[model samples]
Target: MLKANLALLFIILPFTWMISGQFLFSNGDKILVIITVIALITTLFKYGFTPFKKNIINNQYIYLLIILSCISVIYNYFHKSDIINIRSVLCVILYFIFIPLNIISTRVITYSTLIGSIGAISFAFWQKNILHLDRAVWQLNAIPYAACCLILMTAAIILCIIYKDKKEILTISILSAVISFYAIILTETRGVLIAVFSIFLCLFVYVFTTKISVKIKITFITILITIGALGIYTTQNRLIHDTVQGFSQYKQGDDLSNTASRLAMWKAALLLIPQQPISGFGDNFEPAIENLYHENKISSQLYNLHLLHFHNQFIDTTVKHGIIGLVLLLLFVFFPFYILKKTEYSKENKFAIFLLTFGIIISGLTDVPLEHKQVFTLYIVFIYLFLKKTHSVK
Candidate 1:
């Protein structure tokens, strides 16, 4: 019992920050490493090596992908070009760290998420209202900031419903949900807006069908639709205008707009995949884009910038590590959902997994999520915590 309490105490800040600290660059990574070390020590002292064996076996797909990724690194090393992808390697390390983490109670997880939502929205407000920034960017891109806010908002809203019997937690979750929604609006990211509306519709239908009075349900849906419509109305300047403008520019033979650039990169990635179907380009992905430019296969507008990745996660993984890598990435993302289905976990656990899987899939359509360390850590750690069979007890 002492060991369990100690583990929870050590993880509270780091786990909370995982949800809120997408704006942090390297500092978040450092804190994660430190807490992971503490988790490792405490878990070992409490349960020895036996506990590690089962979770590791349960998460075989994740470990398999990590192994293959490391092999790719070694393969690139011998080839003497595109020798390493530090981001991928760092993600692998994060996965390893999460395995030893002791399972935190559901209540702790709920409160931590509440704290995280407040922190995330506070930062967004500071950036937009106080600093007067065009987009709420601080040490991270606005796109990712919006994505993280979406996660916080979704989690908080769901927690509010799950813990509605508890007045204090319910109140905190509601505040987090509201602030988190505002934070997403402040980001001016179109991709996350699509995700937000999608999730909102899904959650609304979920609540509407629940065992509640018809009038209450009607009132709930009315309030939710009002909020959703208002959010969309507020962001029309960026969401609707930019999308229409980008499509119009593309049709007019101009590929300079943000959406057009993403389209071009996706095209280039598809074309490149067939050329290196098995072994990918490793870290020379950008140079391959340049080659396509010189050959007139892609636009010079895309080639001019030092673009770090293809905006889409699947295409980016396919380009970087080929078909095999893409397969592994899919397995890694969907494995938790699969586990939830095959097991009789609690409803809260299942819902957490569903929200995460849905959010990642939706957001990945517009961004490379794992390339960002904070986002990567957030996904892996939560997946482990919520899905761990033995450690979920309060």
Candidate 2:
């Protein structure tokens, strides 16, 4: 049983994530649900619910999010609003699916991340260089594809620094990071560029807090600088030109460029959030945007863009679920840091937690990642696995 679960985690889960999108999330949920049910029944037949109870007690935030989501589901049901919000938040329940398994290894998780990163970048190159797609994507929307690659890239780098003593692993991990970053640039999801900088800042803070040698710290810094330089050099001309043109077009009121559309969406969301600051629109994001359009609060161009969720996660949450949901989302993301301070996990485990959590949060600023079922599952599953390790260490 242990070996089977390890292989599932170390092989199937990571690879599927890199190459597939909706199928990974929807079918992945079904597979995990089956595993959780079987695990629960077998455990109940022997040890009863004590193990599950203990896990639930330890991870209160997950349940809180679940409870909040249930309320949203009910509210949306009655109001005839879209209940898609439930799909993403309810993924937190799958966190429990791993609690009964003892083979959850940070080393396995790190190596699996490397394998997935390699696969994602390779798949992306095939799409761009061979198939000749406009943007390199890991078989999904460019936004989430870039987001996942960012997580994988940063994870590879952090793991490389953590296991720097292992020469072969370090070399592979560095290669994984480089190729994964190159994939990100190819995707051209400009919003995730902020997430790239946010991750480096996190790496710097982690280096200073640890007792590692100065040489390793410097090497990490050098790697980050090289990656940043590579990104800038590869995309400098288009990035600068498109951004300026987009801004100029927006100011002149003849804009439908990428930057302008996002700004318009943000502006519309801001205007609407104040009206429903308590419970929000409750999955009625499209209708609310329509209302803004009818009232002349937003441009017809933006309204015609047919945005389902505001590009910004914070604003999207506030608009859809109101301020309360926004707070819960923040708590869910930053709660790991609280655990990190309270626990004595090793440096690698700690950085893993930090990198993954911040990767989602920062990228979310310019994209509503939590709106996607897959991104939600990915975040909760990995965070719990890492946190479980800390719980044992504690």
Candidate 3:
């Protein structure tokens, strides 16, 4: 029962941000994280710490990543004003990497998908129908809100097709997928669409290339293609021409253009990276990049738009944490793909994690999905859950 509760809370981590956005004074992630920590402690006592100790050598890359991140944070601690924030980040690194993936089961993964789907779908419905908003963003900025929508949507699909849960849960899973699709459309985030499509493309390729049943491959491809077509039709602005036009305007140096603004920030980050290419300037990175924008005499529109980080994860990590930081973060993100390829494992785990990690990387190309509370939290949890070695744990 204790384990079950822990699993439920793990799935609801994404919804915490949803709640925080809705309430006037509430810090949803903080409250949920505290509850999760308490639950984790209770399970640790009941099950013993052995769950986290298994297969340490197999996950040497993950530990190496944790060490590098800690070292970088410590380097910045003496000079950065946000000393507490730096420490908090180090703690998070430890917490995520050390989670006992032994506790994860098929049931837990499906439950997380169902619950997150329900939570995000409800919020999206409320924002669109009752609020009468053209773009349904609830309490989150459009980017994070849209990121949550797609993540939950993908989770719902994985719950159904990958886990192959009971018929009752299968019904719920299908419903969740439908609702997630609707929410993704209403949110109108281009990155969300890209992430979702990338998921389908990745899955389709997997199903086709693997020795899976022909029926499964055909059925899955048909469903995904149909859904993708419908989604593209429903969201008119999420069109190829629209994106091309944005790029064209950006190329023309349109300061107000979204693509142009993102480019400006990326350029600014690249310019400053050479100055501090080792240990970064650290927390509250706005002033450093902003200063460069002034020196370069570029338009200040991105700063005005409250664009905080470089939208690209690789670029942003390199800027704030330097080349060493960038290497660690990349290994942390991509090591699963490397390790899983060389070893035998459950196809479900491989596909689930691949779908997730791939979507994140693709989305990161155009936006800062890592900065969003929902995206990073989900990534950390799923990474540990799917990658852990199979060992019996009580």
Q: Over 4 Å off in model 1, which ranges?
A: 1-8, 42-103, 136-138, 346-348, 388-394
Estimate TM-scores for all models.
0.84, 0.81, 0.80
Whichever of 1 and 3 has more TM-score, that candidate is: 1
Model 3, residue 141: C-alpha shift (Å)? 2.3
Please report how far candidate 2 places residue 35 from its true position, in Å: 6.3
RMSD of each: 3.8, 4.2, 4.6
Q: Which has the higher lDDT value, candidate number 1 or candidate number 3?
A: 1
Question: Which should have the higher lDDT, number 1 or number 2?
Answer: 1
Q: Give the runs in model 3 whose Cα sits over 4 Å from its true position.
A: 1-26, 48-65, 79-103, 134-138, 165-170, 284-296, 389-394
Error of 1 at 393 (Å): 9.1
Error of 1 at 352 (Å): 3.2
State residue 57's C-alpha deviation in candidate 3, in Å.
7.8
lDDT of 2 by residue, 1-394 (tens): 9956554444334323422343224365555445445544554555466656666665755665666677667767665553344544443464353344443354555566666676667767777788887763345577876777776687677657666777766777788788778888877777777677677777777777778889977877787778787787877765677888888989988538887887888888899888899878876667777788888888888988777777898998888778877876787688778887887778687778878877887888789876776666566666766665532210
Model 3 earns a TM-score of 0.80
Please rank every candidate by lDDT, starting with the best.
1, 2, 3
lDDT of 1 by residue, 1-394 (tens): 9856776566455555556553345566666656656655655665677755655665654564567567657766754333224453454354344434444555666677777777777777788889887773364677876777777787777667667777777777888888889888888788888888888887787777678789867877887899999999999988999999998888776778888888877887898899888868776777677788889997777788677788998888888777877887787778776777787887766777787678878888989766666666566656666665533324
RMSD (Cα, Å) of candidate 2?
4.2
